[model samples]
Target: MNGEDELEELDEESLHDSEALPAERPNPLIIAASVTARGGVLWLPVAGLLALSGKKKAAGRALTAAAVAMPIGHLVSLVVHRPRPQAANIPARQALPEHPDSSSFPSKHAVTAAAFGTATALEDRKAAILVTPLVLLVAYSRLRTRVHWPTDVLGGLVIGALVALAQAGIGRSARARATACRLFAMVRPVLSDHSCPSSVSE
Candidate 1:
């Protein structure tokens, strides 16, 4: 075929392929995933509730784990500055309603979910089972929304798990416990309920 005719044929094929692809639209799964991603906000309060419920040691570990992991995730995202799956030429719906202003190498949502669940598991395994599935769901949501690649979510999960484990270890150290006691004491009076525990204890 002549050059012009070949170009025209290729254009037609391209048009057909585009037409065959489904149009992007919101769905129940995507919506639910978005809600699950609010994991960041949801888990912190859960830790607080645990403290209020008198599970202070579990709450302290969970809170500490989350605090440590989230900042690491943010810093990693900044350092790596990787593009989102959609930006990387991967086919995805880009379904998230609002996009974050950081790199997609380690998904913040996945990190928070993993850190929370893992930390909770260290405190109480039964509770972890309930949390683990939710964390996995949030990770999957990052993939489904095209905000992250599989590896990105994996990296986030690893980082979060490691941080939680590290926190648990440190919590067991006498020096760390002393520091924690001082920290807790300083903050307890500021609590409106004045019911916040003054030390991490099982």
Candidate 2:
């Protein structure tokens, strides 16, 4: 948490990005880390909160936002289907597979992480800090997996950002609606039979 630590972290990240990996080791580790980080975000504590909480409305907002964003992301992935780094003329140190699948556009890992990350962050601020690193790992995994170019990771990042933004918007709108309902609740007795307007849609 010191300036030196921050500088060291920054330098490490730069090395990760800029260094030409030996074409075998980095990708696998990146891919594995991506899975572990993302799994941690989606499976346990956050999922448990969604399952156990009585705050159905808030949890529902988060889950619904995730449900909406994920497919749209993959759909966008298909639309922008760019070739893998190995497929383009860029020479990798690793040999290309004989049957290379052509879809290397938006990374599914990134999109998945984004969708879940946005949901968790919107649901609870503390969760976002934990989720943030997964986003980076998933983005990096595309390269480490040898399934995508760095630019593909970049594109996936944009897609993830947009997805997160959209979900966050939904969360915002839900909050606004809840606020309106509370406001209405205050005024309901004055004219509307003391009825608290429901915020069920959010």
Q: How many residue pairs collide in each prediction?
A: 0, 1
Compared with the true structure, what per-residue lDDT tens digits does model 1 show for residues 1-202? 9976874464334212243322244356754765655637767667777777677777677767877788889999889987654332323354455656568778777787788888989998766766688677777666555565567787889999999988778766866667666777788887774543545532
lDDT of 2 at 170: 63
Best model number under TM-score: 1
The residue ranges of model 2 lying beyond 4 angstroms of the native Cα positions read 1-20, 27-29, 34-66, 87-102, 192-202
**lDDT tens digits, residue span 67-145, model 2:** 5555666687678766654423323323333334657666655666666666667666765676567666666655554
Give the true-structure RMSD of model 1.
Answer: 12.5
Per-candidate TM-scores read: 0.65, 0.61
Cα-based lDDT for every prediction = 0.68, 0.56
Quote the positional error of residue 56 for candidate 2 in Å.
10
CA RMSD, predictions in order: 12.5, 8.2
